[model samples]
Target chain A: RMDQGEKKLSSVDRTPLHTEYVKSKLNLEGKDEVRKLKLFMKYIGVYGADARISGFSGYICELLIINMGDFHRTIEAFAAMRGKLVIGDPENTESFDSPAIVIDPTDKTRNAAAAISVENLSRMKLCSRLYLNGKMPEYVQSNGQRKDAKDRGTNLRVFRIKKPDIMDDILYPQVMRFKNAIWEIMERNDLRPVSWEVCVKDHIDVIIESENKAVPALKIHQGPPVDEPSSLDFYNKWINMKISRGPYILGDRIYVDLIRQQKSIGDVVREGLKKVNIGKNIDDQKEAMEIFDPYDTGKDSCALDLFLSKFIFRAHPPEKTSRNTRSS
Target chain B: RMDQGEKKLSSVDRTPLHTEYVKSKLNLEGKDEVRKLKLFMKYIGVYGADARISGFSGYICELLIINMGDFHRTIEAFAAMRGKLVIGDPENTESFDSPAIVIDPTDKTRNAAAAISVENLSRMKLCSRLYLNGKMPEYVQSNGQRKDAKDRGTNLRVFRIKKPDIMDDILYPQVMRFKNAIWEIMERNDLRPVSWEVCVKDHIDVIIESENKAVPALKIHQGPPVDEPSSLDFYNKWINMKISRGPYILGDRIYVDLIRQQKSIGDVVREGLKKVNIGKNIDDQKEAMEIFDPYDTGKDSCALDLFLSKFIFRAHPPEKTSRNTRSS
Candidate 1:
């Protein structure tokens, strides 16, 4: 041990004077070096009986091996430098009957082999796609072919077919009563359907109108109506029509189910309808709900519209070649 | 329509002249109003057929119904003003549908909910766990609980394990190795174990002394020997004795692993031993590899000690029971 210590110290350029000084202070073979090492260990706060053999290397070892000193002094200096140190026995330290130093031949190579093992595990890559009722606007130039989605805009409407086996012959209209509500706004505001930016942002806006009428579009899909008897009936018709149509609309953005939130649409509509100061007649109430609360008008309407737009316009593309193509 | 418009317009008390102008505009009947709406539709670029029935609310519908010219002008003007807008098109003229609308039901709600309907779907939330091996320090707590990889530290090595049923106890050893590496760093620096931040930044120097010591641990896995054949085969016999007894070492900051990097233990040991100048007639390169490298009498022993420390300390943990624990 003394020889080893001398060799180690000599390697570090410790002058003959310093070497003599340390040698005079502690006899490396007489456990004095161990004592000094222990003191340095305590100062660094990280020590293990077989660390040298066990392959544990840390700051405490550096402080002791390279910067030896009294335990208290070393620790004090470390603390001053904002350095942290800790020492604790592992949970199952007694398991090794053989001192870690008693390394076998296999042990020697295993450590070397372990050094080069690759460990890039536990990562996942997911891919998905989204389809729209109409063609997308972006163009892809693949193999010198330029295809753009803008030209397919006219086919945006999701069509419902009454018969799945034979959908081409019959066409059933999905409920679009919401357009009437939109028309009321146009007429009231004398608002012309011109291309205009809605705010200070750069997002584009598009409007559609007939020669003499304002059409309404579904802003959000709240799934099938729950409380509204008419809505329930309407959905039944819509589904049957869709089944017959052969499911032309298949996209990642399409939600087959609606989530229940704070309240149902019927309740919101009913509350809004009740706020009307018109005559107390039932017809008036019904009309009020239709006109005033058109498109379920409320602070939520704007937000709901935004959601629908995002789903329809901005969603990851799906992987599968939409089954809709097969139906066509 | 005119009377209803007049009644509603009368409620807004602007200047009398403004009111008169509004009244005159409101006097138009259905056909005339529809014409004005059509113009707005053309300017805005929205399909009139879909808009009329898409269920747009009064305000949004008004925007949609604005004349195409006006709509374009609005957007252009808004652009000039550096304004932006996001709008929904039921016809999906943009070939994208709206997905979700995020809004606060009440005013000043920090938490908000997004509305997603069956027709339009968005994203979903998933809950999972992450595992880290090693002793956690006090500082780990002061940091935020939610995981933001950007702020990762070194005291703990984290791994996210989403599926355990499919993965068979692979992470335990890897985590152990990672912890061991960190332990090595702590010891080399002569400082207390610091926060995870230090580990990630590689702030702490990890001194892996000699790769020879890891031989025994690697042998347990029965993996290939280090690339180079050497006299160190004798070490395997010694390592086997420990294997017969059992294999497990536990500690807060220390760890072990059967799996290691690409290089074999034999390869590293051979390399390290060859570099040692243990002079004289030791002809077996294998034996030489096992011997510590002899350095010139002017270099620090810290690097050498740290380099070989791994051979003494690391031990693969017990079977992976808490592999998926968020912070094991």
Candidate 2:
């Protein structure tokens, strides 16, 4: 590496600090058990050099092994794990926001498992639990996409958004933001999604499961209080409308419950997207925004897998496995 | 009335302090301008004593007149008021909560308007605004029931509970409680009620106007988190159920989106009511839960007025001007 005289050049093929830290963390015998297990877990899903999975890194596996003292113990902790997983909170949780938090013992500033995504963490957790329960799901051992929820009587939809030409680090967060924005928009429209997941890879796919796959005809619109100057504007626009139920005061505000113009989830998204700026990738992708219905076949096979892995077979053992799921 | 010997026995028809307070507060002309306006407001709706309205006493009228310096100003204040109304906090708001707050200058410990209900306050505010705006709604000057939302393309329902055999104060609060309880329950069931009013008159009428008079079949059921011990129990209950969906992990808890048994609002309320001990008044009122569909006329004419008063014509000065007078 060359540098100007003002900025002196220095080079070391391998840093002593990082090498020492990695070596000490890998106390397991043989040719690194952490690396082997991580490789073995990779075949089942999206896990490679540039996979979208957040957690389950080789270094994180090493740290987890060191923290649990063994591979079996690490898997056992995962099997027994319910909600949160905190591994060595050196600073005692000053600010940690991730599915799993594993603070680096060697360097307090670093977090070994901080990059792990909820999808990956839950997948690993579920796999561990299933392996321990002896009813191991075949998806972990074998590979390929997830199964369809065809006969499941579910209202699930998946939108595969094309990734931008930006860097992965920059693109991942944007995808997440877009996912959350859509979730919030859907909720406001009364689609009330029960489960949702966003995966960023070759493409950014947002999958959501909701109660009302369709939309209702009516929605209540809250206006400014009756005494405000703005209330007059609100009254003038809605009061005389045949669709408006009210131009009356309730509590402090004037409200009108009227018929919805677009009463479908698809219509809402199609129209709602046009209102936001939503960056280049989403805006530029010509054939983007592919909606795969729960029963859709062929092209939706992989989406079905991601949705199932993230929602249904989520690797976490099912809690309610036997009785009636619906209310009577 | 005679008091105990330990306290004191007095024969003062009117206390000197109260008389002095009223006199000093009434800065307007001869025959008590506040009294005349208060009496006029009473004839139209629930303002009269033992009528449907709650709060707005003669003492409160006196305080309002003193605060505004005259009847016109008091009415102007109401007309211009939008949301919250707070008056004369000589001590700068030492915690007060009411629909409207009028601090009694004479007795600093009391809030003369503390007993005011949101319904009565909003009615007065709307009426005042309309009267001042010269769009004096006829309902403000007449006495009758409400109207229907049949032509409005809206969904509204009314539940008129027979008042429990109790005193005025006791029964009124209970009616309010029942109204609030039903409102919350309906909201939980996704029947978003925009306007609701409770009137305890010939019958304890609890009228409600909502967006979803009918119910949806689908409902999302939330379960314990993936790590909880009960989560396994929850799993055991629903995993094999014919009606179940994902029972998936989202964030910390397990959730399942499934179909509800009663897909109609009326059915849910009827069956839901049977499950809880919703007091005897509601329990004993046979044929009490009458379904008054706006378009269904034979049984809706009477309900229309109640629903209209409690919801629609609430503020647009009552157009119909002549009927029986309660207070003159």
DockQ, in order, for the candidates? 0.01, 0.29
Backbone clash tally for model 1?
158
Q: How well does each candidate superpose onto the true structure, as a TM-score?
A: 0.17, 0.72
Error of 1 at A265 (Å): 42
lDDT winner: 2
lDDT per prediction? 0.24, 0.58
Lowest lDDT sum, 10 consecutive residues, model 2 chain A, at A319-328
Docking quality class, candidate 1: incorrect
**Model 1: residues with Cα > 4 Å off, grouped in runs:** A1-45, A49-68, A81-328, B1-57, B65-328
What tens digits encode model 2's per-residue C-alpha lDDT throughout A1-328?
1124544322132246556776865654723667656654663332332324454665566666667766677778887886557877546444576677777565554455666666566656665665566644344311222233543434677777777778765676666666676677788897777666666545677777776666655567788766677765676676446643566556667777666654677767766766664555566542357777746544533434445554434432222211133221
lDDT score, candidate 1, position B163: 20
